[model samples]
Target: MKRTAAALAALSAIVLTSGLVPQAKAEEKKPYKIYLSNNFVGNDWRQQMLRIADTVVKKAPLAGRVDLKVENVETTTQAQINSLNNIIRTKPDAILIDVGSPTALNPTIEKACAAGILVITFDQVATADCAYKVESDWSMLPAVQAEWIAEKIGGKGKVFVDRGLAGAPISEQLQSGFEKVLKNYPGIEIVGYFNGNYALGPEQEGVASLLAAHPQVDAILTQGYGSGAIKALQDAGRPLVPVAGGGYNTASLVCAQTEGAQCILETNPAYLSAEALKLAVDILDGKEAKEKHVFVYGPFLSTDPQPSKLYPDVKMQKIEVGTNAFPDLAPGLSLPITPDWVEITPQEAAGS
Candidate 1:
């Protein structure tokens, strides 16, 4: 028995010294490289979108599997084209784009596609035939709010129209939707039309200047910049009128506080970055999808339906405002729409 034990120990020693002992085989994971080509970072929504992408890429299952790089440039078509040209040369596995012009980037996008790189465009999308698009339905998003505004004013009142960036496809789509509804009500005079630029400060200033010139405004129709309009009205001591806007954190709270104020919050959530990233990852993983165009619809926030409230009888496309305006969330915080796979909380989004 002793000899057997000694021989076994000697064999073990020999195996260790000879490097015959098996070592753990480290996982050979090839990180999928992704590049984000953003046209602008001038607004809160755009910044939030980028942050969402960062968080999504760092989460489990994607943490070690993805290598993401983001590149931002001025909001010009030529700048974006130059950026795309430079990015294509790096030969990443996929490219996610937020463009300045719809058709300006088509040739470069086609070049990338031909080079075997997957190209996906989200908000501020391009008209590149070779690129996949992920975006919300712009027409439906504003039509519901426009209808609500018309309904609140009994189809006949002076209204102010706050537009987003001029020449932007989303801006044009939203305006078309709102105008289509407003056309049904000839009595609803459009008092003033100003470009809100989708930013709070610019919107506030523009609304304020318009208010100074036309103090008889009854309601405001806006694509974004709700909070700025709210403040402008408050500063002017004008009676709060029904306002409609794209999603704004501060606007949601302000609307909740105003006595006679009625507003609609239907925004394209910022987590769309995650959606774009998800598409890139899926494609890299060889997941097949039938359609290249992805459409996300906006959710209409119904108001608190209380008979005592000034705007209690309002409804948006049959979606009634629920019991709480901002349930389980603080005021002035943007809502984040995330799928289970992305795993992001609104608080995390807010903080970021």
Candidate 2:
């Protein structure tokens, strides 16, 4: 009897230990599957954005936690929708979209949300209520820049405005913001408007044509690279005027190097993709976001630095060579290249 009791106790101990091992295995969290659906890859910004997303998944904290897949589609809303439908069928844990159209992707995004897939639209975001949005505070960029331009030119001048890419939601928003700020200063006149199309060639051509027509232009508001506007001014033999443009490496460098240039550059950073990925991982890990829409703000880089009355909260950094402006890097490299949490070097961000 004593021997049998001892054997039964030993068997119980083994059973208990075996049961605990599977319980611990069951508690181990599996890596979540995440997909990035990029609508356009034609421009340098889009390329860099995609690169940043790819880099994030391979780095610490996110490396072992996410299985990221990127799907670049034709620059059409329908193409993205079709691709998203296919991705939905695969049932990924999350989907991040740099949407082509804001309203057109609502239904598809809703479908994904219904299927329990977290949908996050960054950069050019969608209007789907169910999906979360991660974007630069678009309203702040134009408002502050326009204010700077207004102040720089003594609250009045003939300003040229770049309408940005045609039919893009961000373009419309930026245009509206510019107009809204400039309206307060009755002396400021928007002498000319052109579609920069968010490219160097188009921006240069458009600005050059505008400069020819409006010889007395005082300032320029560019939605993309400011370098194009500076080049246009130089080509036309027009003196460099105070210009507000996007935060591109070339834009800051050109603005800093040009003898008479007075410029302010603001960024919608490409690290937004990485931020979206991080948000997705957080959600998947059961950390509920306090708000559905998350706005990531980048720095305001300027040649003549001053506090913004409109957006005082926004950080304004002096555009210094080798700091914000990299002379050695590619022209189209976006500014504020590295996010605070990640250490993405200039070469990596430039895709060198």
The residue pairs that clash in candidate 1, if any, are 102-127, 302-321, 303-321
The candidate that achieves the highest TM-score relative to the unseen native structure: 2
- State every prediction's TM-score relative to the real structure: 0.84, 0.93
Once fitted onto the true fold, the runs of candidate 1 whose alpha carbons sit more than 4 angstroms away are: 1-28, 304-333
Model 2, backbone clash pairs (residues 3+ apart or across chains), number: 0
Task: List, residue by residue over 1-352, the lDDT tens digit for candidate 2.
Answer: 3568889899877887888435666676788999999988877899999999888888977887888899999988899999999999999999999999999999999999999999999999999999999999989999999999999999988999999988889999999999999999999999899999899999999999998887699999999988899999999999889988989888999988888889889889999999999999998888989888999888899998899888778899998898888889989999888788878888888989
By lDDT, who's the top model here? 2
**lDDT per model, in order?**
0.77, 0.91
- Candidate 1 lDDT at 121 equals 91
> Candidate 1: RMSD over Cα atoms?
6.0
How much is 17 displaced in model 2, in angstroms?
4.5
